[model samples]
Every structure is written in C-alpha cells, then in structure tokens.
Target: MRPTDIESLIGVGRPAISSDGAFAVFASSRPDLAADRTVGQLWRVDLAAGTPRRLTRGVHDRSPRLSPDDAVVAFLREDARGRAQIFVVDAGGGEPVQVTDQPGGVTDLAFSPEGGRLAFSARVPEPGRYGTVEGRDAAAEPPRRITGIRWHANGLGYLDRPAQLFVVDVPATDAEPFYPPAPALDEPRARVVAGPATQLTHGDADWSGVAWTADGAELLSVPDEIESRRRDLRDRVVAIAVDGGAQREVLGTTENLSIASVDVAPDGTVFALANDVGEGGVDFVAPGVALFAVEADGPRALTDAETIDLGEVGSHLTFDGDQVLVQDRARGRVRLLRVTRTGAVSEVLGGDLEVNGHAAAAGRVVASVASPESFGELVMVHGREMRALTSFGATARERGVVVPVEREVTGRDGYPVHGWVAVPEGEGPFPVVLQIHGGPYAAYGVHLFDETQVLVDAGYAVLYANPRGSAGYGRAHGRSIRGRMGTLDFADVMDFFDAVVADDPRLDGDRAGVMGGSYGGYLTAWIIAHDHRFAGAIVERGFLDPAAFPGSSDIGSFFGQEYVGTDPARIAAQSPMAVVDRVRTPTLVLHSERDLRCPLDQATRYYAALKSGGVEAEMLIFPGEDHELTRAGRPQHRVQRFDAVLEWWSRHLPVG
Candidate 1:
C-alpha cells in the first residue's frame, strides 16, 4: 500500500446486539479522500439473514445503541457546530429525531434497562469560560485562574470544564417492531421533544461509564478526581439515586488499585476493572487491569493480575447471563475473553485476532476484530463458532506489495522479544527501518497499520517490535523498565533489531534508519546518541529531557517522576538530551506545534544541541496538530508526513 492507499482504509466499531439476539447494529467507517475527512454510517444485520443493511443516512453517525424492545436506534451525530448530539431513528429505517442540545457536546450514551431514559455525559464549562457566555469566543473570554494540575491533555486542549452525567427521556417510537415491517419514508419520524434534562452528577470530577441498574432505581458510574489524582492517582465506583441524584460510594480501590469501569448486576453484584498502580500516587508504568467482584466486604479479584493483562484501562466489561465478557490483551493479540462465575477465564472470540468493542446477548457475542491481514471488521460468535461479518478491510492488505512476517529474538535477561518485519516487493537486502511504538506500554499488534504499509510500499523494509516495556506480555514485562528507562528496555530493542537482521538475510542492517514517536521517539534518540550505529533517525514528539518536562508538559507533573524519579542524577542518566553531544547520526526532528504531551520545546532544544555539536539535523513541525498527528490528524497532513518520510529515506537510507 502506498501513501495514497491510506485513504482506502476501512474500520468497524463494536457491535450492539439486540436483547432478543435477532439482529445487531454497528458503525462502518472509511476515509473520504475527496473531503479529507472520515465518514461513517450505521448498518444492521439480521442474525438469520447474515446480510448487512444500511440503517442511517447521516455522514458521521456512530455509537449506536439498540433500544430494549428493538423499536428505535439511539445514536450520536455531530451537529453543524461539531458537537455530538443524541438522535433517535426507527430501527427498521427513517429520519433521525434530534434529542438534547448540549453546550460541550455529548459522549458515553447509555439506555436504561427498560429503555425509558437515555444517559450521556458532557463537560460543563465554567460560568464565563469555554463559550458558555453566548456570543463570546474563547479568546475574548476571561483568563482562567489555574488551580488544577491535570488541566490540559493532548488532542484535547485546556480541560478546565468537568464532565457531568445527564439523563433525558428517550421519546417513545412506534409501539414495538421487532426487526421486520420497515417504516415508510413518508411516515412521520419519531420526535424527541426537548425537555429539561436532569444533571445527575456534579462537582469537579468527571463522570464516565454510565450504566443503569436492573431495577432502574439508580445509575452506576466511575467518578474520576481530575484534580486530586495527581496528588494520588485513584478513583472509585459510585451509585447515584435517579430520583434525588444523591450518590453513595459502592466501592473504592484498595491499596494500589485504581478503578477503570463498573457495572451493577441484576442481583446487585458489582463488577469492576481495577488497575494495579502499585501505590495510588505515582508508579506510571503499564499495569494490568483485572476483573473484580465487589460485595459488601470488599473487592475480590476474579482474574489473575500476574499473567493476564485485561486489555487496557477502561476496556469493555459487561455481565452476560451466566458469564462476564471482557477484552484481554495476551500474547500481543487483543481478544475477547469470557469469565465464568467461578472466576475461570477462556477465550470466547478473537483468539488469534486483535479485538475490542463487544456486546453480548442471548448467547450471541459480537466484537470489532482485526488481523495482520485486515483492519477492524465486525466479527460475531454464536453457539460454538466465530465468523467475520464484513469484508471491507480486505483491500487493506493489497495483493503482494506488503507482507509482514513475524520475527522473534531473545533479549535482555533472556526475555523473549517479539516483532514483525515487512519487506517490499522484489527486495534485495532492502534498507531496513526500525519502527518503535509509543506507550512503552502500547504493544505492536496484528492490525494492518497504515504507517508500516506506507513505508514498505516506498521500497523499505520495516521492523516493529514489542520490547520489554510493552504491555500485553504481562505486568512484569511492562514494569521491567520503570526506574531503568535506558537500561534493559533499550537493550531489548537493540537485541531485537540485531537478531531480526541476523535471521533475515534480506534485511540490510548497515543501511538502517531508526524512527518512532513519543516514548518510541525518546528511545530512538537515546539509541542514536548512545550507540551511533544508525545512518539516520527521526524522533517525533520525544520526551528528550526529563528535567524540563515537569514544568511544561500536560502530564509533566508525574510522567518523568514515574519513569526515573525526581533525582537529578537519575533523570539526566535517562534523558537523551544529556548525551546529545554524543550523537553522530543525521537526525530529523519531527514534532507538532500544539503537542502538550511532549511539548514543542523538546524537539527545538534537541535539534539546537545537535546543530551546535556539529551534527547534521533537520526539524519538521506540523502546524495546528497535536500529539496524535500521525494517527488522527488531518488526512492531508497524514499523507504529507508519509511523503516527507519517504523523501528523507531516499536522501539517506535509500534502498539498495
């Protein structure tokens, strides 16, 4: 796939199964090259027919939810002003009825057990801030009085506004139409007359993961302490009475645990996903979130934390009849796992696939799944078999231009390092480019990632690995480099590259280029400065200096401190800028103008030091973009970045 093929990629979201298990609904998305934006539409499938039917005509409709009786489909669509608003459409077909008009938009839409009420969340801006004052723009508004440490985030600018829970009546649709008997186009569509919505949550905290209890008397949610988490990273599950809006703590994290998602069973059994943060306040290393059953006493672990990495924080967790469905990341593949009442876990779907976004009902389970050969596609599991429901992602793998072959090697302390090597067609000792993933916690999975595809099409072999610090392999592997950033983690990366090249005769180790973003960028710069083996390096949004980060980055307060602590000696030892004078490879510093995660100062400082040290270096900054540029940036910008990367490789590590 070439840079142009990036526009041809297709993706599918999680499926929402009907209570009766007769049908399912999901959102299908594709890049609109002409508009340079992503567009999606809702599609429905009759479980028996197994054929998908278009359900909505909106340009970007998503987050589909099937009403209890399956008469209407409640979904979200961005309004003219780009704020997501709730809309309801007949399940069979028809126009959508607009619901609430929120100031900051809405998200996390949920329908009550009886489908009488709709619950959603939106950030409430301060009295005169965030466009709350009509006719007043953000720039013209009063300056904010800073008080919170977690005030901003990448992709999302200043986050002074707190997200609160809201509930509104989901207007009644035509009595009940189980699946068939479509509604006529001329017939009047269901209308949700705007009524005063009840704000069920208040305070400085953000309320998310909204779910209604079986009796519909109360709502269950996780209240995040946006301000106090920096002082102590912890959260708890709370139950709010729907009538009076009074909240009471259902359960709080014990010792080193942090709450992710929670749900109340019909019998009042509370289930939650809790992350092990070691001690609540600091340790930012990648820790596995496990399933827990909360009772009057305390929370009980339903899944092992040592070996099972239950996906990431806030992963899907729902209670099916006699079992619980959850997403787990094990062996680098994100799969849907089923846990029984006895705490026994087994893979129900996505065994060899990267899966997420799941819904289960009447013994039928549906999830959005992907493989190395495909992007996200809807997959379903019924009775004893799992099958793919869509084939839109087949074009993503193209015929033979790109092939990613799995590679493995033994790294530091004899740890088994895993990765993949994608070689272009008709390659002879192709110039190899080693790509590292961010998160130090995020792993390289089986998805058909567009970046690796674009690189191989440009006639360069790409190697990406899940080194020691990556998640999926377990908590031990993820926490191995907590206070030793430049030690074993770096050794594992180098070992993986060296071993892969030695095993594959087609990979030219000498004409190599190392590149990555975020944590990956930090490691890339650290590698070149320490080893000087690469001919070129591209460090994008790297956390180059740990000392200065504490003051400038959105996550600065605790990011570096969690990595190597606040000790000056330890920080300098882990920072690449401390050894910038030692770099000898030609480097391209890539960053965004508004990346609050690493900030623009990191790249400018690193590049300046490289130039002053008599080394070849260039800086490429994308204006009006954030830390997620390569992934969720403007289509034109993503394409332009690929072009620039190919151009740099042509001038430096050109293919033989």
Candidate 2:
C-alpha cells in the first residue's frame, strides 16, 4: 500500500459480546476527508451467521457495552461540542438516546448486571463549575489552581478536574423521562438532557475500570493515587456500594503489589493482574494474574512459573465458568489464553497474529486480529477453528503489503533475541533503518505497523528487535536493564543489528540510519552519541536527562528513582545530554508540544546542545498532540509525519 493509503485503513477496538451469545458490538473508525477528521462508529456482528452491520454513526463513538438482557447497547460518543457522553440504542437498531450530559465528559462506563443502572467515570469539576468552562466570560473566569504533582497528563492535558465514579438510572419505558427523545431524524441523534447523574465517590483518587458484580450490590474499581506522594502509588481494588454507601479496599494494600485491572465472577471470585514490588518500593517484577476469594483470604499468585506475564496490564478479564480468559503477548505475537482457578494456564489460540481487543461470553470468543500483511479484521475463535466476521483490511491486503521475516539473534551476553526484517520488494543491497519500539518495557510485535511498512515502501529495509528491557521475554529479561538502562540494553541492540547485517547479504551496513520514540528514542540518541556508525538519526519524544526529568515530567517524581535509582552521579552518567559533544550524525528531533510524559523541554534541551556542538539538527513540534502522535494522532498529521521521515531519510542516506 502507498503512503497516502494510510487514511483508508479502518481501526477497530474494544469488542463486547451480548450475554445471550447472539451478536457482538465493537467500535470502528474510518477517514472522513470532507470533515478533515476520522469518524468513529459502532458496528454489530451476528455470531451464528457471521454477518456484520453498522449500528451508530457519530462524529466519534467508542467503548461499546451490551446490556444484560441484550435489549440495549450503550456507548460513548463525542457531541458537537467535542464532549463525550453516554448514548444508548435498541439492539434491533433505532435512534440512539443520550443518557448523561455531564460537563467534564465520561472517560469509562459499564452496564449493571440487571441493566437498570449505568455506572460511569467522569472528571469531577469544581463546585458550581460543573466540569465545564462554557458560558463564562473570559475576563470573569477564575484563576487556575494547582495542588497535585500530576497536574497534567500526556493526551488529556491539565488535570484540574479529578476523575470520579457516578451512577445514573436508566430511564424506564413507561416513566416520564427527564429529557424527551428527539424526533427520529434521517441521521443519528442523541437526546440532550439537563441533569440526572448522581456523584458516587468523593475522594481525590482516580477511579477506573468500573465493573459490577452479578448481584449488582457493589461496583469494583481500581483506584490510582495521583497526589504529590505518587511514589507510594500502588493501585488498590476498591468496592463501592451502588446505593451510595462507604467505599472499602478489597485487595492490593498489605501485600504491596501494584494492582491494575480486576474482574468479578458470579460466585464472588475476584481475579486481578498485579505486579510484585521489591524492597525498594519499585514494581521491578513482571505483572501476572492474581486470584482472590473475596471472603476466604487475600490475593494469591495464580501463575508463578516465571513464564507468564499477563500481557497487557489493562487487558479486560472475563470469567467463563471457572476459567478466566485474557489476551497475552508472548514472544512477538499476542495470543488468547485461558487461566483456570487452579493456576493451570493453556493457550486457546496461538499464532503470529496480534490480538488487539477481545470479549468472551456464552462460551464464544471474538477478537480483532492483525498481522504484517493485513491491517485489522474481526475473527471468532472456536477451539482450533476460526471464522472471519469482518473484512476491514481486504483492500490493503489485495494491494500487496510487505511481510516481515522473523530471525533469531544471539545477544552479547549469550541470550536469545527476537527480531524481524522487512526488505523492499526488489533488492540487491538496500539501505537499512534500525527501528526501535518505545517502552524499554514494551516489545515489537508481528503486527501491521504503519511506520515499518512506510519505510519499506520507501525503498529501505527496516529491522526491529526485542532487546533486554523488552516485555514478553519473562521477568528477569524485562528487569535486567532497569537500573542500567543504557548499559545492557544498548549492547543487545547493537549486537543484534550487527548479527542481522552479517547473516543477510541484501543489507547495506554502511548506509544505516536509526530511529525510535520514547524509550526507543532514548536508545537512538544513546547509539549515535556512543557509536558513530549511522549516517542519520530520528529521535522522537525521548528522555535525555534523568536529573531534569524528576522535576519536569508528569511521572517525574518516581520515574528516575524507580528506573535509575537515587545516585546523582549515575543518573547524570546515563543521560544522553551528558555526551552531546560526541554526536556527529545529522539528527531530526520530533516532539509533541503538550507532551507531559517526557515534556517538550526534553527536546528543547537536546536540540540546543546538538546545535551548540555544530551538529546538523532539526526539530519539529506537533501542536495539540501528546506522546501518541504516531499511533493515534490526526489522519492528516499522521500522513505528514510519514512524509517527513521519508524525506529526511532519502536526503541523508541516498539509496541509489
């Protein structure tokens, strides 16, 4: 596929299955060039016949949830004012009615077991402001107040408002509604209301992942500490009554485990994903599934074999009988697995395909799968057999996309390293680009990556590997480079690249370029500074100085202390800014203006240093964007980013 074809790709997410096993609903997005934006809509698929149809067409819609009785499908949609609110439609298809019109907008939502009430999380605005700045004159607006360490986030900017849980009653069919439904228009519409939402939690903590028990007595949620003392931020599972009672901690307090997501079974069995904390108050261990009896005893590790790290920390957990199903990232691919209450783990479906999102109900599992050749599609898994439910990426596949070849390389320390190489279509010896993934803790999967494909299509070979600090390679492998970020991980990357160049005859090692973002960006900057073998480098949203990061970044207070420790000398030695005078290669620095994780000051400091040393450097700052620029940025901006990278590489490394 061509670079411009990026706009045509359809993005699918968060599939939810009805309790009766009749149909499934999911959120999807496609380019709307006329509006200069991507439009998100809800779609449904019949499980038995494998037929799919669109349900709701809104400006932006997502997070679909099917009610218990399978009569209503509730979802979140952005209104004309760009505020997200809950909307519901009939299962058979009809006009959707807006349920809640909160000012701050809802972040996450879930339907109660009885379908009588909907529980959602919204940012609690200050008194009398109602979570909005609308209708107030600018001169009369109150001054902004800041009282917390995490006053801002990456994507959602300033955190003046704190997220809290709320409950709203679903309008009864025969009862008089607060807001009457609008006349059925040709296009989809929402019934705007004044007020019906009742606040439940009043604390300063951020509550997320709201799940209700089978009896609908209490709502289970994960509360994250966001105050100044964030180093003590261990997530706890809290139970809040549906009738506005006191909230109590359920688990993850005494053991000091960092709990993330939680799920409750019909029999009061609770399953959660938690990471063990070391004596230093850092979660250096890999996360795994933990089981809690709720009444008998506290949480216990279900999988302690050292091979299982619950793939996505925030992945949804579903209980089927006595087994809990979840998606896990193993090696480079994501697979669906079933973990029994007895701690026996088995893979239900395993392959090179990446499972983005999944939902299970009534003994059926549906997931959105993608690979190197295909962008994304919906598939239903039945034991070993699988059925395709949607053709989301047929056009891209038919047009012939590049597929990566997997290879294993030995690290300098004699450890196994997983890597992939995607060469251009016709090649003798091609200029190579070493791409690195973010999250020194995250791995590069065997999936359809837009950046990799674009690089290959631009007549360059792209190579990526899971270094020592990457996930899915077991706990020890992930934590090996925690305190020594640039020492061991850097060696593994350079060794892997050298091995790949030696094994492949079609790779031109002399004209190599390096690029990465986040943690990968840190490595790219480090590589060019230490070993000057590359002709060019692209550093995007990377951390440069561990000393400056502790005060500037959103997670600044604990990040340096947990990853690099408290030694001032060691922190300075590991920073790329310390060795800026050693960098001789031309570099392109890309950063988001509002990025809170690494912050824009990181790029500014690095760029100033590079220029002062007479190194060829350029910086591009994308406005109104955060750290997720490459993945979920605007369609126009994404295309522009790809074009800029291709142009920069072509000019610096001349492939002819």
- Please give the clash total of every predicted structure, in order: 0, 0
lDDT tens digits, residues 41-111, model 2?
A: 88999999967888887788888888888888888998767788998888777777778887778998888
Model 2's C-alpha root-mean-square deviation from the true structure amounts to: 3.5
* TM-score (all chains, Cα) for each model: 0.94, 0.94
Per-candidate local distance difference test: 0.82, 0.79
Cα lDDT tens digits, model 1, 1-656, are 87777766777887788888888999988777677777889999887658888899888899898888888899989887787889888898887777778878887788888888898888787788766677887788877667767778787687767778989988655433323334887865444344557998888887877878878888888877766435556667788888889988887655456777777765667788877666555555776788888867888888988788885533777668867888888766887889986899988876557886888888888888877777778877897888777877767755333648887888857888888889877647888999998988888888788888888877888998988889888888888888889788788889989998988888889989999999999999999988978889999989898888976898888888988788899888899999999999999999999999999999999999999999999999999999988877777888888888888888889775
Error of 2 at 369 (Å): 2.0
On a 0 to 100 scale, what is the lDDT of residue 13 in model 1? 80
Q: What is the lDDT of residue 319 in candidate 2?
A: 73
Worst 10 residues of 1 by lDDT: 173-182
Off by over 4 Å in 1: 173-193, 228-230, 253-256, 398-401
Q: After superposition, how far is residue 49 of candidate 2 from its true place, in Å?
A: 1.9
